[model samples]
Target chain A: MVSKELKVTTEAGIHARPAAAVVETCSRFQSRISFIKGDIRANAKSIMNIMLLAAEYGADILVEAEGPDEAEALGAVERLFAEKFRQE
Target chain B: MDGSSPRKVLRGIPVSSGIAIGPAYLFHPQKREISRHPVAPENVEQEVARLKRALERARKDIQGIRDRIAGAVGEYEARIFDSHVLILRDEEIMGTIYSDIRENLNNAEYAFYRRMNQISDRFDQAAGGFLKEHLIDLRDVASRVIDILTLSDGGKDAPEIHHPVVLLARTVTPSELAQFTTGNTLGICLETGGKTSHVAILARSLEIPAVSGIPWKELSLEPGQMVIVDGNAGQVILNPSLRDIKEHEGRRAAHWAHEQDLAGLRDIEPVTSDGKYISLAANVELPLEVESVLRHGADGVGLYRSEFLFLGREDMPSEEEQYQAYRHLAHHLAPRHVTIRTLDAGGDKPVPALQVDDERDPMGWRSIRVSLRNPAIFKVQLRAILRASAAGNVRLMFPMISNLQEFREAKRLTEQAREELRAQGLPFDENLEIGCMIEVPSAVLMAKEIAREADFFSIGTNDLAQFTLAVDRSNERVSDLYEPHSPAVLRQIQMVVEAARSQGIPVGVCGEMAADPYLALLFIGMGVDELSMSPGGLLEMKRMTRAISYEDARRSAREALRLGTATEIHQWLEDKFRDLFVRLGLRRGTGAG
Candidate 1:
């Protein structure tokens, strides 16, 4: 398993579009990806699960991936978080 | 709780005015007529394959809606569809649904529905805000898949509406609403929307009773159940009781009688009792509205919104196509003045053919700014207006002119179009009067400069209020802040009136404010030359104009100017006009009445 802690930098953190982008990116790999925000842990590939986390701006979330491509999946998710989900 | 018994009532924003009681037609565009059946044990693989194919079809459907919404609105609004596509493709949902169908020996439809319900319940149990809203996206994707899986014959064509119905929907596009009008659509109730939305405007124009902003999903509504839509009061009653029907019927009859009373004043001139004549005109959008303008005994067609020709179309209207539309109105309302506004596109009414990418401030890259930048399009419209002028008494007007420079530029383009027509020896009205719409705060301050180059002035108080107060009128959050009766907004109208008077030109008001009886009297009192509104408002405004003395209106206007806030102004006007309104049998909060 590969894990990395990242902060939501977008003004509207984990909004519909960002959450959607996160799910789209995480679902691409053959790995089980999860996002942990404090006590709430959500499957990164499920939009509803990610959105339920309600991770606001400047909040930290720990991204973990487990499978054959765990390392690749974690790297991609970290890059997406750093890019703020590419929202305008 | 009984199927045949009366249900609860819902409240919403009263967008259009009327009263309608009819059967409820739950209009779910993505709703499917699917049935559940236990699958044979041997055909389990077939059902799973069916589910996979349906998912693929659902994903394609979402992509189509995404592309269409992107084309019509923009990329930002279209992003919501991206999430819907992902939900359809989600392995967690697909894997669970497929397994349920195989193991439980259930039909694909039941499997998919059960899984969707489970996921949506999770969404509902989660924190509100973003998570709660995701339920809609989830349902949207599920519905698409269900629709594809259960695709059957004869389930199409506007839901088999056999009787007149109060159509209920989450949200309706203008084109969808247009389809329902062909049927026996009695009224419209939306789960979401504001008064300024396109659907709402179309409803008002069609004279349909409409109530928006209802949480319709929370309500349990069955197709063909009785429903009551009280647009004036913004109430929607599901499965209305007999008593409710009787009560609404009584109110409807009373409202009809009041309308008849107003219609009686249609023939009477809009001159105050003290003999100050106020020209009452109609603001027309579609050419079909010309009949209503004439029927209501309007003096002429004021503020002809030419944007209607360009809206909801794939390409820009050709010069000849526009000329024919304007000419039709001019000829029909011949001898009476037709102040046709130039292409007021780019704002809320964006022309797809123009390909204007700037959606930042739709109000910003709109109106005269759009025309001035794309002079070729502007000149085409101006030339059409000039050509239409040859058909009848057509006057040209420009909208959203913020300063003298924009007005001069618009006027210069008109002259260029005129010169082209003159050189071509095309018969056109050479002496057509030109006007400017004072709708911006800057225009109010520079009214004198703009009035110099213009032959007349028309204050569009809707945009004027929005610009003066820096409030987006369409935004429900700050819609109350967009007050036309506010002291600041009223003072601007007063300034424009004064500015026009100094230039020896006539001024009129062609906005929602002009249709308002209280503000109509105030504008008449403030020496406004004309007032233009919907045909429904013409006779009522005419009745009010004849009832009050010019001196009384002038005094009231003077008093209103001293008020500090919109609430104060509203209170004063209510105090002054409520008695008169009551006497006229105009019901409270009923714009139709």
Candidate 2:
């Protein structure tokens, strides 16, 4: 399993755009990815799950991936955050 | 009560300003009721197959919306549907739904509804703001699935609309409102929502009268009952008395005659008795409207909305297709200058090619923003406009220009189109003037700076009022707050006129405000060079222009500017213009009450 903590960078938090980006990235890997918010673990591959997490700006969440492509999934997820969801 | 009995009138918030008399078309979305029926053990596999089929259909539906929205709006807006697709594809969700059908022996509809509630509950428990709003998404996906399941057997049919009528509904979503177009929806009366609602905005743009916040549920209206929606006064009268119908009909006839008499002055110049020349133009949406523009003796087409070509279609119009359309418009209106505003798509307008899903604020992605973001699309339109310029007296204008930088960027693209046409050895007008719409408050503030680049300025008062007042004109709750005659808005108009005058460029007012005779006078008095409105309004505006002197208009405008509030300005204008309007035979029972 590969795990990394990422911060929500956009002012809107993980809105529709970022959630779609996360789901789009996670779907590419053969991994069971989940995002861990306080007392809540959500399926990272599910846009609905991540949006439900509603990670606000500056909120930290742990992305955990289990499967063959765990490392790649974690890296891509981190990159998306670093890019601030590629939204203006 | 008998059918002929008149009930007390119900008042609502008027979103769009008009008077509509039509039958009531009660639109009640049929309830999708699916009761749980236990499946026999032997039929479990069949139930599973049924569930999979419904899910697949729901997925395709979402995909279709996504693709269409992506093509019309933009990728960001299309992403809103991506989550629905993901929710459909989520193994955890599907696994639970499938197992619930097998283990619990519940029907697929029940299993799906329960599963959706489970996810919606999680969202409800989550932190507020973005997360809380996501419950709607979860429900939306669930409903789509349910819709597919219930609709599989063709049990329910969409309401069959036979004629144009006043649509009465509890509430309507934006997507539902999009389907209401087809000329059958004469007006709208809703139980909920404010002027800023998408339905209200759509109604305004479509010119369909609408009112909201009415207790439509308590009205008990039949399908063909005569309903009068007075959007101007925010009243809906069910089963109006014979006297009531006669009174409104009489007023309607008088109003029509007044319009006819004004139209008779079409051949007369709009110059005042004191020799002040004021141009009366028409803002046309469709090419067919050119006939009326000429019939009304409009000086020119002040604001030609070119988006009509891009909208209500499936694909982006090619340069040739757009060129042909523009050529047709210029050919019909030859010799009269037509200011074709470049493709102002996006925002409230859903162009499948330019859709950007900013549900919270759509105004940001529309107009020049769409053109600036997609230069290829922008060039196609600019090239067409330039090509059409060669056919007749044509000028190009850009809408929703927010600042100098945006104007410069749009201008740079137009110049590129010009250079490309020049290289191709195309016959085009090289000296065709380029103008920008001063709609946004920022544009009004920076008008002096942006005016230096533009050949002229056309004030889009619809957007200017919304932006300056910080009110969504479509939201019924705040529709009353949208005041075009506000001192603040008038002052902004004054500032834009001053900016255009400073640069020796003409400025025109081309919004719904120009249709109002009193406002038209105020604008002319404030040094506005042109007044552009609907073709139906051109003749009346011209008559008002010729009847009033420029010096008197200037004084009235000055006095109006000194007013403290909107009501004051309106009352002052009415009290000031009442006698003149009566003398001119323009009073059609529409005098301010």
Candidate 3:
């Protein structure tokens, strides 16, 4: 598993809508994805779970991915955070 | 209100749905596009001259916005244009275009276009379709430079106001809309916005009746077209005939006269001609709306839709932030009851983080369901409302409680909130009345059960009709099916009324349904103890109530319920109250008490 913390830059953070965007992109790869904020962990794919995180703008949360193409997933997720999780 | 001669008739989709008469100010006039054809040697000098001319024009246009922003709002909001100005002045980008390919001025622009198109590609990465359309923003700046050099503003002067004015535009900037003077502006019209844009808020702040989002795209727009924009109707008639102008003149006059009549009612009770005393509360969306609420004779605020605060904001408001806002609202309307509905995001209003497992079935999970799922967040809201309650007569309500189970569970959470406040020793009205909106069919059916435990029931007719009819109000195809006056909807409301009345519970309405002056008599007669509506609708409703005896309203309700369809009920009301229909035009909703 590759894991690291990245701060959310989007005005609304990695809430349900942005999380879905992230999930939609992540799901394309053969990788398992989950987001962790402190001890609270939730599936990146689940909108409800992501919103429950309440990751406001600039809230840093740990992103982790496992399975095949994990490196690719890690790179993509990092780039997304770098861009502030705003959907194109 | 000038240039009374009918100019040209124009048509577009009505978003605000109203009519008014005034001189037209056609903003965002169409521009003649310069072709992107390859330049031959003979025309190269002319092309270079055109490029220089456009640049000069764009600079002045940008400067006008800068000057206005510097004057009215502040520098911060205008910074978007400032960034655009920076793009125009980008040294490296401009230098690359002019220096890399050609020494000739016209050739320089050709090369610059190639360079900037690359930058445009980069700028479009925000992934906002709306922002992408802002490719036009670049064109606007560029073209403005062209206009200044070519003197376009001279021909496109702001239409002279012969009478008091109602300015119309397609999404006016904060700088443009704010500094409007009473000498010319009666109100304003923005061709794009829905209830929440900053321009809308500021217009309301100015207390001028402004409407937004009339499809200006399809209108026969001219510089000096005689126009009447019913900000309420979102209707604009260009060069309205003499008869149409006189007709709207009567409506506008009566409207202003009615304002004077309602000002007297502001402090007085909403007692009918008889001894029956009823509550006249205002349904508010934003705290800023409280002014209109007070202006239109609302004794108290019955329904404060807190969801508005969340609109256009980034995320859930922190408890402290919520507390400050609630405190401000409650304090401003001191001694007046401000019943705040907790965050009830449903339909198309879900927070990205906040989702409905089933968007199709609103009853699937939104409003109270979302609140129930997030207890801690809800506690923050409850605490804010409770804390704010101490400042004045304040209460909290929940939305979408279809059964006694959810109501009780919500109340349990409320008690939990109370306990937390007690632990903190926060000054709060512990016995504040907790109410639930009666929208879902199940909620109406279980009103008695819900009523026994809750303080009151506020009928949300908008959602009540949608849920009962199983229709999406937003879907134009099914919009006709979403009728508030149908027998099924009436029956559901009657059950709620019966439940409220049987138990002597106070019931109020805070939906577009209650704001309808045509339905004013019916709602009051249906045993609704309070009517909450847009402040603008207050006097008209009051007048409507005064015209019809309670006896007539009850009779209409009974007759209306027996009708098969809303259309039939509408026909029935029109046939009976044809004069009232004429006065109200059986038209112009989305404006309120």
In model 1, where do residues sit more than 4 Å from their true spots? A1-88, B4-16, B27-128, B131-160, B169-176, B189-202, B211-221, B232-236, B264-277, B284-291, B304-396, B412-433, B466-488, B547-583, B586-593
- The model with the greater DockQ, 1 or 2, is 1
Tell me candidate 3's fraction of native contacts, as a decimal between 0 and 1. 0.00
Query: Positional deviation of B156 in candidate 1, in angstroms?
Result: 3.8
Clashes of each: 0, 24, 29
Error of 1 at B186 (Å): 2.1
> Each prediction's TM-score against the native?
0.73, 0.67, 0.62
Model 2 C-alpha lDDT per residue in residues B201-221, reported as the tens digit of each score = 446545577788898557766
Residue lDDT tens for model 1, B351-378: 6556553253646667778788888888
Residue range B186-255, candidate 3, lDDT tens digits:
6566666555344554454345566665666655555556667665554566677788789888877776
Q: Fraction of true inter-chain Cα contacts (below 8 Å) kept per model? A: 0.60, 0.62, 0.00
Interface RMSD of 1: 2.1
Docking class of 1: acceptable
* Overall local distance difference test of candidate 1: 0.81
